[model samples]
Target: MTILVMGATGAQGGAVARRLVAEGHSVRGFGRSGEVPAGVEPVTGPLEAALDGVSHVSLVLPMLLERAEVDRWVEIVAGSGVRRVVFNTANRIPPAATDVALFESRRAASDALLASGVPTVVLRPPVYLDNLRAPWVAGRLAAERVLSYPLPADLPVAWISHDDLAAATVAALTRDGLEDDVLDIGGPASLTGPQLAAAFGATYEAQDVAAFQEGLTHAFGPEVASVVAATYHWLAKHGGDLYETDPTAAERLGIRFTPVHEWIAA
Candidate 1:
């Protein structure tokens, strides 16, 4: 089957494409610049043009974009005769109760798919573990020798690994009987900011969580600090685990989920 992947050059899409190719499937990746993995075919043009002859599609659209573009993409894909679709959605959206702008946009897209009669699956994943490598974490690791963020010490979070997300996506793409459903993928265990800090400290000789948070503020500014703080605050008050055990993912993918610390080490 020929699968067309949107955002093929990005982290999630790239991992999905690589995994599919490793399993011996033909993949055509659609991207703005038409750049893709070495084994996959890189197709030029917009999402609409890339939909031709595509049996399955994986949508990993950009976040925090205008709603119009999101709607347009969905409209085009729905009309394109693509049978199966996997949409990457956000786990947490702003304003909590109301649909997050980004997730709302994706929900709209999912609606379009349903209205068009295409089989669709939504994958809602939380903040990735690889986010630690971002300037917020890396710069702090380099400069302050501390791991600091606005998130409270005891707040627990399930930080999913990108590799695990990719594996789950592959399972969704290849499996049957998963139409019009939402799957929340999370890490195997939930850990607090201090725990993550401890993990890093164990890895790097002189680093700690205070340094991480400090570095995050330094690299991302106060807005990020506020966001991180809010996330932890909500988690603490909510008192629910972000980590979920998905036997479905494991059964379909034939692999165990990756743990947060193991992913960080990798």
Candidate 2:
């Protein structure tokens, strides 16, 4: 069976595509950049044509898609003969509506996909431990020996790795009886800022939320950055938990998570 992976050139999707390839599965990677894993067959032409003969899909949308764009994607996928879809929402879903554009847009997409007459599984992941390796954060950590983030000092986060998240996606795609389910996945342990910093033998600094937003604005445009930053800003004021300490759902699926220290060392 051929599995179609969207955004397979990006970090999360790249991990999924690589893992699937290593498992001897036939993988078709569709990405804007056209750079897929070594073994993946790149979908260079139309996506609709690429969906033909595909059995399952790993759907990873851009961080900021408009509601209409999300709907359009669901419409397209619904018509495809694919049997299953595993969508990575790429962030935490709020309990109630926080009115943050990014979160709400993703929520709407999840709802649309589940109701699109296709067997779909939505995976919501919390903050990624991989983010620490990004240039902006990594550079500072390397230079100053500090772990700075826009989270409260006491807030505990069960940071997940992209590879672990990829395993969950693969499980959701291959496993049965998970249709129309929304799962919140996380790492094994939830650590506070101090504890997380200690993993790298670095000092912890609570970065200002506004300053964090400004950094995002510089990297991503102001429009996307504003919406993305709004979630963190809301979290600062509302103090909603970003991760599940237990990760019971992941365990039930037989998905294993990498430890933070192990990831840091790697």
Candidate 3:
């Protein structure tokens, strides 16, 4: 039962690939960059060739893909005879459609996958703890000892780490009786901006959405940055809702999320 992992070169997917390999699973890694973890095999040719002999798949779609292109890829994955799929939506689904292209596109892709009757599980992860390592956030924290973010000061977020996310993805893929289920995975604690900064022993500073957007634009081209920034803009308007509300989800899924201090120290 070989598992095919998409975007294995990326942080999230790389973590998953490594964990799966550590567990002694047969892993076939697929990424545009043609890179995979040491134990995993990389696929440099067509996706179908990589899909061969695969029983399950870990799908991680890129954020910059257009709706039509996303639809095309979803169609292909749905047609593939894979037994199950663990799809990382990469963002929390909004209560209703908003102007944020990323959320809408993810929702669309998730709906298509579920509608495909592929016995899929969708994982909606909030802000990644690993994102703190990004130059914009890390630079400020290191040089000025301030943790700056565009989120509201009081808004609580269950920030998740890539390792925790990888563990959740593994459970979603290997566990049974989870077909067609949607999960919102998060860290052990839900923290506000001040609380999160305190964990890092740094001061919390609320950054303007425009400035945050500008920083993102510099990191990941303008198009991807715009959509990501739009999500924060929406969050600024809609506060007090990013944390995980499902109290029993972690215990039920057998996932133990890592703490902020542990993540930061690592």
Candidate 4:
């Protein structure tokens, strides 16, 4: 089956496309920049043409998670013979009862999918272990053997990898009877900051929310830092273990999640 993958050049979308291709499926990408993974075809025309004989679609929206774009994409793919949609909300427990702008945007995106008349399966993945690969985060680990990030020390987070997310997404794309389902794509288990650091053979250094903002400012620019700092502050203050391992979902989806230690070792 041919799969139309939006954001196919991105980290998550690229991972999904590679997994699907490795499973012997045709993959097409609908992205503006960057190259799609080696075996995937890059779509360069209208959505109507792109959807011709397409079996499924995987969307990776921007951080803003605009609702209008969500509605627009779904509207085009609704009757285009696309059998399914696998949307990554980049959040584990979305639509939380909150006035936060990020949550509001993600909630709107999720609502748009449900209302768009498409057979959609939403995967809300929590904090990715891949975040450890970020330059700013990794630099600390490499230089001082310290894992420094914004999340509170006591917080237990279900850290997942983009690879695990890709596996789950591929299962969703090829399978059926998951029309309006929402799955929390978490890791094998939850880990605290120190526990996560211990996997890297590093010492855990919890950063102050303010210090995190400063570090982000130094790594990225002010505009990016301001937008990111809000979420970090929220996590440091109130973020809890919003999602846990759903073993039944994993078994049903035919996904074997990677644990933190396993990923670290690899």
Full-model lDDT for every candidate: 0.69, 0.85, 0.86, 0.79
User: Which lDDT value does model 4 have at 159?
Assistant: 89
User: What digit string (tens of lDDT, one per residue) describes model 4 on residues 1-266?
Assistant: 78998878888888998998899988998776748999999986577887888888897776543557666766676657567888887775434566555666666666777777778888888788888889879998999999998888778888899899899899888776778888877887878889888889888877888887887789787866777777777777678666456666676677789888888888
Which 10-residue window in model 2 sums to the lowest lDDT?
Answer: 238-247
lDDT ranking of the models: 3, 2, 4, 1
Residue 44 CA displacement from its true place in model 2, Å: 4.1
Off by over 4 Å in 4: 44-49, 64-67, 79-81
TM, every model: 0.78, 0.94, 0.95, 0.90
For candidate 3, give the lDDT of residue 63: 72
Q: What is the lDDT of residue 64 in candidate 1?
A: 40
Cα-lDDT of candidate 3: 0.86
Alpha-carbon lDDT of model 2: 0.85
Ordering by TM-score: 3, 2, 4, 1
lDDT of 2 by residue, 1-266 (tens): 89999989889999999999988899999977789999998986477887989999999887766778777776788779689999898987887887787788788888888888899999998888888887877888889989998878788788999999889998998887898888888888889989999898898998898898898888887987788678788777776566656567676567788889888777
Q: In angstroms, how far off is 211's CA in candidate 4?
A: 2.9
Off by over 4 Å in 2: none
**Between 3 and 4, whose lDDT is larger?**
3
Q: How well is each residue in 79-167 modelled by candidate 1, as lDDT tens digits?
A: 78877888876454332343234445666776677667788877777667777677655677657656655445565666777778788
